[model samples]
Target: MNKNKNQYINREISWLSFNERVLQETADVNVPLIERMRFLGIFSNNLDEFFKVRYATVKRIVDAGKTGKSVLGGEKAKDILEEITTIVIKQQSKSLEILGAIEKELETENIFIIDENEVTDTQAVFLKSYFMQKVSPGLLTIILNDLREFPLLKDTAAYLAVKMVLINEVDGNENKENKYALIEIPKDIDRFVVLPNEGDKNYIILLDDLIRYSLRHIFTMFTFESISAHMIKITRDAELDMDNDLSKSFIEKISSSVEHRKISDPVRFVYDKNIADDTLSFLMDKMGIEETDSKIPGGKYHNRRDYMKFPSLGRKDLMYSKIDPLPVKDFSFEGSILEQIAQKDYLQYTPYHSFSYITKFLREAALDPQVRTIKLTVYRLASNSQVASSLINAAKNGKQVTVQIELQARFDEQANIEYAEQMQAEGVKLIFGVPGLKVHSKICVIEREENDKIKRYGFISTGNFNESTAKIYTDYTLFTAYSPLLKELNKVFDFFETTYKINKYKHLVVSPHYTKNVFIGLIDQEIKNAREGKDAFIKIKMNSFTSYKMVDKLYEASNAGVKIQLIVRGICCLVPGVKGMSENIEAISVVDKFLEHTRVFIFGNNGNSKVYISSADWMTRNLDFRVEVGCPIYDEDIKQELVDTFEISWNDNVKARMFSEQQDNAYRKNDKPKLRSQFAVYEYYQKKLNA
Candidate 1:
């Protein structure tokens, strides 16, 4: 360990622990059965990305032969990797047990998930016909015995490793045992094949099982004694490597990098635990997998992420009841969202409030002839995004549309690139982003010719401008006509265009330069308040908090008797409640139905509360490398709303987990009203709308 680091947990390990909190949802009896299965899927999906980004980075350090202890929270990269593997194996085992329990519970509900062997005669006939029609043409099989080299397995796609004992007759020789083959699962087809519903009972088969059932039909050319297939998946390092070739455009560089990602170094190789020993050995040898690489022996299925898209089968009884998004009480869609914002700032808390306001705002901007220019920064957008369409509409209507679409937003890179090209073709001035910094700020500003002069109406959001995610991700968006703030937002758009110039911002805390210093200053104020015996408290809610500098600053404040509270949904490195270092600090994570994606910060400035909603977590990458925006809530009502919402999440007993040295992900329970904040928050908004 370096520098005697005691107060901060490793971010990677902390993240794994946070995912355990998600796994906890899978085992929570209070959760609906189908939802629990979906929770497992979420857990799996989260882990896949963690390995691709975090684990791959650590492995890079190990490959570079650096101890990397300083950056990796006082642990060697290799040590952290080993620890991660051990924890993952344990978690994976636990998840399997939870999955089994879910299946049994599902069986009670008359939902049967049948395997190939368990298929009924009538069901087998239907599956055969379905396979011949739907799955046959799409299937790509490679006979491995005669191939010169092993094919490069896809990054996250599942495959079947087959073994056959072929009858070899060479010079009257009887049999030659082992022949291997690989089958790449088609990405276009759905993973779950739902059979015809039998009265009230539901029968579904996995895609892999369907393939297994049709193995003979797939390989009619080869004569074999027996053949078997077990799912195998390779997870490649998804880090993009951009070449410094000046001849290539940014889009070309990104496109090439995305193509290169298909055959990157394999970070993980998961296979069925029951796979034949010879088959596993042969495949491992061909792939050159080593002990350093993660080789997890898994269940029958490898990509359990498909569970996320599980068929609902009209079983509303097995799912959480849907709540209609309420209208923001004072803000009406009958009038322009812009017109209302001009009067007073209104906050839109998503999933609780309809996301249509954002679209309506954009649509209004697109159609309003007076609107001359529209500018925005996008990080992640939805498939078939109306946000992009609105911008395209603005461009088509002769409006000067400028957009900073981030092409490096991880898995969404391809989608963003396609959108960028489409928008560019439509004459929207597309900005790939700042040269080195990804523009992660979720903001949009439009200038309208009101009364023969320019007036701006815009919104700053804690989440993406994407409408699809807005329905599931808990976030905060402030709709305002504040000229000064809009001017600063205009500066952000300018920063994207002019990289050499660093713009100063007074209201919005911009990152890659300002957010860290500004936040530290905020903590320093709290510390000074505590020293002077004035009321001092700092509260925050974010997805993750792993910046050691931020942690040390909070520790310094906590030691000075400043009260600090954190409602982190994932990866909290600051170990709260330490005797001297952080006794005044407390942290809890709330994992529920809706993802807690909002970033809110509050400071008790001598009885008056200062609040902000941000796009950035306290992670190092977000603070030091990305262009994130943290907007202060100047409106007192919205400030109180944020404070109230934070309190609700902080008081959660049903789904909140405490953060401590143990890292056990223990649920925070109390003898109060069972406040499930995700549900409570919806009701809170509903009542506000009613009142």
Candidate 2:
């Protein structure tokens, strides 16, 4: 097929549009004051990762002198790079404006985010003591002018570029020599330092400003006429470059790659717009940064991602009210959870439902005498993960526990490597995953002996088995003792051990072999139903959708009169609502307090519906490169509940942005009452519990 350029959005451009939605949260009036500031932080953090990974990839293509049109969704790689920089610069400027408005509103609430210039004498005394006692111990300062080679700047670490006009003359001439230095911001310290509260006001100082205030103290030995400091940061390419060293273990290779990322090629350089021209040029020249590289001019602060951890100041009124996680309806914590699942299927929707259910299940498996074996896949886990502890506990209890932990989970390599070593040390048999594919599936199956027969019980999820993220990331976990599905899930684990042999799954949708074909078959069925004048529709919720083949298939379905609704949270390359191409398709993205991380696919199979919760999106990597899983919803009640939740998100009038060809992330508005899906989902589950 000859692909048209206008048929789809470039993936990089779509990603920027998604980040813009996050930036919009900072400007929302209805959003809580402190939460808005944190949204700005989230936006900044998302941009850093974009540059480190996506932007870096395009830069590589440009460096290779390749057009890269076929891979980049019909756009040249060089053009995409330029477009990304332009879009990012504008978004950075807009974010600053939003930050300004949020600060003004915060002042009205008796909170002040004062900088170094605004520090009072009383605050100065407090700051100086805090700096000496807390900051000075960990601060890294480098004198740059005298060294022949400039020190390597850490990626994403903000630094203060200090330039001082020295008092002494240079080379016996009248010219004064300039001394330059770089001070690494101490990350161990809190970015927002809350000062002692006065009568009715709260004061907080950013760590950047506190360091700026202490520049004189930091350079007390040097005598200079004047001094100034500006914030600068560099983002490096984060792609892991694994070596072919037969002598090294897989863990060693991943650790080496992670360590190498510290000095990888720089993809972006951002500096304060108000910085001295001489200072900016000198630093760039010293670092060998070229004009062609992405150099973004920004406000005073460089790493605004720190704002994600902005102090709450005990102001419950300035943030969204925390919702207590509800118990899954009809699934009690009392007695054996395994016994309960053996009777019927249950779905645990996290944040709305307690994550403790996962931990509870694992802990039960670890202690149960009948449980003989447990196997699962590990992608990303929380720091001090209870999941890891439970796995270790299971292994220590003499149960044969096998873990296929992916050590290359992007910026999580080091953490996973550490967890892998810990689990291996505690007698958990470790599988490093298939050589060519990262195991991204979230599945667990335990074999328990009952009446001379081995009964299998398992759970499949749309998110990682991490407790910390479960509080804010909305996902679905299906607990079932159905032997048919559990048997196929065991086949997935078996594939991890023997990569060359292909496995067939009759129940669970396994990726890298069957997912694309299965989903295509499902879409084809819907297309046939629409042609037959039968009930035909499709609903999907995912983090991203960039597979062009799938987009074309959806377009074909839409052309055939199949009604399609998509809730994609990020990087949707498919252009929805286009006339002739996708007129019957509509898509929306919801960004609110909780991240919409679940991936659910519902297809109207003539009057009956087929529902699935998947670990994968329709992205190319997920479809053909990574090992992913999508399990069908067989239980009638659970399937209806999944449909109900997707409907709530689909009908969200607030916090939902429509995806269109214009790429302007416009919020969906209507005469109908405002319904925030995140809050409404909680209420839906609450009523279920009450019933």
Candidate 3:
């Protein structure tokens, strides 16, 4: 038996494969042209994060001089690092090719992305004025010759490495004294500069090209021959290091770590392949880049992620048509949303159904005289969060508002810290996090003095409370009046403040304690039912699944004749469709306009199906390290609705890619009517409204 044949796939490689599926959207003809360009942005942004985190982790293992086979599935740490670089290089090349094709297509649509040399005389005047007024003042320009120490390049910012050949004869030979300079791109300015429309045609110049056009203005002091600027970007390891200083506050350690990130070791250096060899070498030598660090020779544009903010040019036809989120059926803003929840459970499927219900609930809680206290757990919030404002409002209204804010939400630590201090100042009590656990659960519960007895109403979500992501991320928020569940949700908030008290939950499958065992028990029930001559099946939808324990248990269930179906969006390590390993299991991934973020697990318990909505994936961190919550759907209607949504996604022939041993990301095809699941989900909600 070959160990690698039917075993788990490498999580890093699987993630890259998932990102390739995202890159596929860039080349997919069916996607909107502008949207396809933005897909390239998404792909680039995804790769940047991959290098900062995953690649950095593998590199650390190799640096620590360990094979890391036990931690890294089976591959040695060095081998995985090399494999990642190879895959990234190939993907980056493919992305560039796809970008070239899109540019040509844009030209046919009368949208021209011109270079510096291609700017018209009128456009030149516009560019000069714009650069002087907007781009020049804040720009940091460093001349390399006289400087004893190299200025620290910002981790988030890209730089233009300028090579000016001093043609005039000095003590040196001709072109011998090439003066090197670095110009950091202004972060405030927009990357895409829209040139004035020429008749019916739309023209745009990238910020780098604009800088290239005005390079002389930036470096007027130097005696020059021909000068050229090539873009270069470096990604530093963004992992936060918290030293054991018992005196320092948690926020202090986090803040210091964030500041330390600016000077962290470079994990990847992306430079223009067209750049002169000397320029690249100068950067490499000065930056102290090692052989192990990924040095990728990329296209002229290093940060194509700026394309995510590509101007729409008012060409709605070249973009996705925006859909207004519909109001939930049987729910209205006229009366208390709590009153409606008192009647029956309502599920808020955001970006399909308006996320307003969440805000409305919080706003109502803030103003309601009967509402005495509010408790919530926040992992991430919007840039300008109405949710935070509502919590503060409740606090001001003399309500005891308590927030268990997780300070360790990656990439959003600064934002979380800012919100935490603001809320604390406004009289809202804030809990940083548990002793060792990141509170990943999306929950909020409020107690109201109803009829002289305390009645609790709250929501449990599979996504963050952030309204910004609610516009595009597909997630589930269950608005329930069930006291048992709310009581357990409150217990979770209690557990955040008091870590030693391990409360048993009857309704929620919580992490670090019960999630693994509870889920495994559920699978065991399915396995037994399958063996006892009963119809048995399991359907799970999540963003990732890398837990070997979960995978092995699923395989055991599959061997016992239990049919298992998985709809994992991003990283899936389980090898489905193997003859003996997982012949009864099948998996598919959907990467479309809206990210598939809802985690719904459905199990066929004899004839009745048991359903759960979770903030946790099957990954080890989610199940063991994070304070994740998986809420069982006790309301039959919501349970059925979740299962229906899962089935809709599962049966998708369009935009659905089958997960097989080959990992080719092949789209699923069928003779049945073509259904794009995201669109169908919208239609599904729409029908509910009309009904």
Residue-wise C-alpha lDDT for candidate 1, range 438-464, written one tens digit per residue: 888999999999988999989999999
**Candidate 1 accuracy as TM-score:** 0.98
Question: How far off is residue 527 in model 1, in Å?
Answer: 0.5
1-691: candidate 3 lDDT, tens digit per residue: 1244549889999999999999999999999999999999999999989988899888888889999999778789999888988999999999999999999999999999999999889999999999998988787888886777778887788999999987676667555478899988877899999989989999999888999999888878777878999999999898988888989998898988888877888899999999999888887888888766888989899888888988899999999999999998889978889999999999999889899999999999999999999999999999999999999999999999999998889899999999999999999999988877889999999999988999999999999999999999999999999999999999998898889999999989999899999999999999999999999999999999999899999989999999999999999999998987889999999999998899999999998889999999999999889999889898888888998899999999999999989999999998999999999988998899888
Go through the candidates in order and give each one's C-alpha lDDT.
Answer: 0.91, 0.94, 0.92
Between candidates 1 and 2, which one is better according to lDDT?
2
Per-residue accuracy of model 2 over 1-691 as CA lDDT, tens digit each: 2334589899999999999999999999999999999999999999999999999999999999999999998899999999999999999999999899999999999999999999999999999999999999889999998789999999968999999998876787656778899999988889999999999999999999999999999999988889999999999999999999999999999999999999999999999999999999999999999998999999999799999998899999999999999999989999999999999999999999999999999999999999999998999999999999999999999999999999999889999999999999999999999988989999999999999999999999999999999999999999999999999999999999999999998888988999999999999999999999999999999999999999999999999999999999999999988788898999999999999999999999998999999999999999999999999999999999999999999999999999998999999999999899999999999899888
User: How do these models rank on lDDT, best leading?
Assistant: 2, 3, 1
Model 1 scores worst on lDDT over the 10 consecutive residues at 1-10
Model 1: runs farther than 4 Å from truth?
1-5, 169-173
Off by over 4 Å in 2: 1-5, 169-175
| Model 3 lDDT-worst window of ten | 1-10
